[model samples]
Target chain A: MIINARYIAFWGCTIPALQPYVEKAARLVFGELGITLAEPEGMTCCPDPDITHMASHEYWLITAARNLALAERRGLDLMTPCNGCFFTFTEAISELKRNGKKANAVLSENFNMTFKGKVRVYHALEVLYDVVGPENIKAKFTRSLNGLRVTIHPGCKLLKYEEKRLDVKLYELTKLTGSTILTYGLERLCCGVPLMYLDADKAIELRTKPKLDRMKEVNPDAIVVICPACHNQLEKGQLMISEDEEYDIPVISLLELLALCMGFSPDDIGMYLHRIPADDALEKLGLI
Target chain B: MNEIHPLRKRFRSLPSSFKGLLRSELRIGHIYELTDLTVSDREDLGLPSKPPTAYSDPNALEALKRIAKATNLKKDTGFDVDKLDFEW
Candidate 1:
């Protein structure tokens, strides 16, 4: 058990608006694991890396700094499940530390905020693996996910900052649930989310289909993920592909998997809201 | 290429990105607005209908609006923030 296992939950735009089930599962899993995810008022978007950064580099930095300053004010570290938010925070924090004086001047002038660089940012996996050790997790597990076999989809941003070791953390955490992790050739490929804006059909066919086709060869029980964007892209992309092609692999968030092992029912974590019904996977776990 | 390109001559932004930015600037401080169905689903799941972030906090939206103004986002992107219009 880690001391002060609490963080300001940065629920990036995608999870709250598009996928609330992921949010619910996170809350349930964290609560069971004795972690406090405080939702402080007035925290805005991680500003969304895809659009905000592309629009204006300075605006993105100042906005992210302002959000970071909110957590700094409370003297608490921040964590997010969305890979996009994690990437933005890591990038913004790094840049702000270099130009701290200029960024703070803008924050203090406009928002009466200061980015003093007092806080640390983390992906939820870091909190799970690094902060709360594997020993604690092993002690807390009520049931084993021994028979369940799944493939991992560690989204693009997690791979960007290799030092974070998020990919290894994800694999180890899934292993804690006793699920077998199957490998696919295109595991490192993008989920085609960023390309969707340019051409939806081509995005699926080019980026997503190749990955799905490779994963299909192994025939896993579910596709596990940490980022909501990739989870949404992969699950939604399957339907967008040709009707003749069969790609019905259920995409499950990592938090939901841990929650199930901690003795929470599938419905407790809102697995019912999954785009690809987790019914087949749940049936395998004898959870249905 | 410029003449035939769907995104180049007109909006100069992807439709999804443009629409998402407009939504963030105008209403919710986040990209996608919390629809009624989502709200009901959240409540049914025993969580708050709206999370405590910008969706539920007016000050967060005000801060984002001010940040946009302070950083010259409107000028840089040529988005008419006042009228909530982006030239298509």
Candidate 2:
């Protein structure tokens, strides 16, 4: 048997503070796959790549490099469940390498740190679908989500980077859980999380509502997302729009859904953490 | 010298499920080369990057261009020695 590849779990800021349940479910799934996820000490924000990258390129690179330096210290790559965090780390590394000597020089002089550009970064979906094959992961499913139907809102950062690869991995793994992926027209839309930084109202209108309206048609058991920011935006975004009976679909993390298939009871992963609880999904999957 | 898998040349290995298995280590920046290990042992020992060729993330590049254009900075410019200069 191939020993699982070890990695530093980069939880970013949201998952720990807002969605501890994601961290919990991800830990459970990682254990089942024989993957070793180490949480490095002294880690800070992925620092909001969308803003930092826009506001100050230098600070963004420096902050992201500090996180990368932490993983390099352990001789391991970083794995993140949040698309924004993954984009910050991976994009920072990609930018840093373009002018390796200069970026390294800046780090050594200002922060007294060196970025060897060796450490790699991956989104949680990438690790699940790529490192752990879909079949291998499917084999670990003790119980199946037999009748469940899901609609996924893949966050924009991942779409901007590796849409084709991320898209393939997501459905393949979702199918492995024995659930049907309900198709929606705006499945590719942003969660409006980034827009919240610029325009709260417009972000809600352009990002969440239209997509949620489309998602309603499939009448999915749940809306699953691989990005924590999306998880927060979609759920909280739903609440911000309107509390009417017209719009009330629960949003969940991809790890939580996979955990259900892997024989975890909904209560175990803290489904209550969701802004809109997973009661319908849980009851549908017969876990209740 | 070993050969880079024709499919992996563009990082598009067929049977998507098997593509991730073929490469030794998936590096975002470095170019990958052929593996010397037997087909069975290949996945065991990650294929290493020798020439260390660097590549850009298209999304990041495109976004950075927008950031640069909005900020009135050169699109290709990033952190450099000029930003690091400090005097005691």
Candidate 3:
């Protein structure tokens, strides 16, 4: 389908600063799909999913509401690939709606602004799966990864949050590139971000490592994730673990895969930035 | 998270629902359901380590109630907070 669509690309804190390659890949893929990832000025971090929530519920709510307010003023729905940002926005919006009067009062008194909760917040996978859709995603598949086996982290915000409920679109999106999504026992575990402030070792030992250990048994070509923090955790977790001692599975984003499938070369689509090189995965698919 | 919030002290002792969501934060394990296990549960099974805590954070229920309750706008008007559980 030939048409124009626009979304306020909520880059949040991680992607632009630590993970620009994700932005590069997402841009390339979205450009190819004819979707516009608009960047409106004056938007800040989703603050954080766990940190802000734990540190100050009030400040977390206020900061997150600010980003949504900016997007709402723009009349465009917010879209983000970071599950943390997605959680912040989605959770904040939902909370604001449920308690509009009180939230508005607090926000107005402190920041001289009100959150009407008008705009919709969406994860990148949600937009791709629900808006761009599987059929269209399939139509753009120029390089097939049919034999490539991948593991999906799906991200916590998209899956577990009680209100935001999990959906199958991320699964469907991963399958669109013709890659196999390897399922394991600990597939739904956290990335250790919440405990990041409390204990780093515990986050890895308890969450990331066990899941990686189990995924090690499956021997997938790469791990696919929709969230940036999870992307960093899984990728960084491998580096933290002794590759000689554990699974050093490569991690890649959903947009990167879509870019590769849409005829973009590995280097052009920002594959080199991954901690564990995606070269092997791309070369295996003959997209090098 | 910042230094000014109340949750910093409350995090360790938050209700079971929060604890359940902490361990099963991604909802992949479903801690409240049969899928998740505690540290002792893991040890009993001969697993190497205990799971970290991080479950689905209600996403909004607590925030809504907290905000409303703070402003004295909360009402029992038959609005079930339990219905907030299925929001994904």
Top-down lDDT ranking: 1, 2, 3
The digit string of per-residue lDDT tens for model 1 on B1-88 reads: 3757756654355366556665564468787788999999999899889988788888888887777777776676765556556543
What is the C-alpha lDDT profile of model 3 across A107-131, one tens digit per residue? 5765566788679887787777778
Q: What are the models' TM-scores?
A: 0.93, 0.74, 0.73
Q: Kindly give the stretch of ten consecutive residues in candidate 1 chain A with the minimal lDDT sum.
A: A1-10
Q: B-chain TM-score, every candidate?
A: 0.69, 0.23, 0.20
Q: List-wise, what DockQ does each model earn?
A: 0.61, 0.02, 0.03
Query: Which residues of candidate 2, in runs, are more than 4 Å off?
Result: B1-88
Candidate 1 per-residue lDDT, tens place, A96-210, comes to 8888776788889987879988899989999889888777877778988899989999989999988878999999999999999999978899999888866888898899999
Off by over 4 Å in 3: A102-112, A161-167, A243-246, B1-88
TM-score sort, best first: 1, 2, 3
Provide the clash count, candidate 2.
2
What TM-score, to 2 decimals, does candidate 3 have? 0.73
- Which whole-number lDDT from 0 to 100 does residue A196 have in model 3? 52
- Please report how far candidate 3 places residue B36 from its true position, in Å: 43
What lDDT does candidate 3 reach at residue A186? 79
Interface RMSD of each: 1.9, 18.3, 15.2
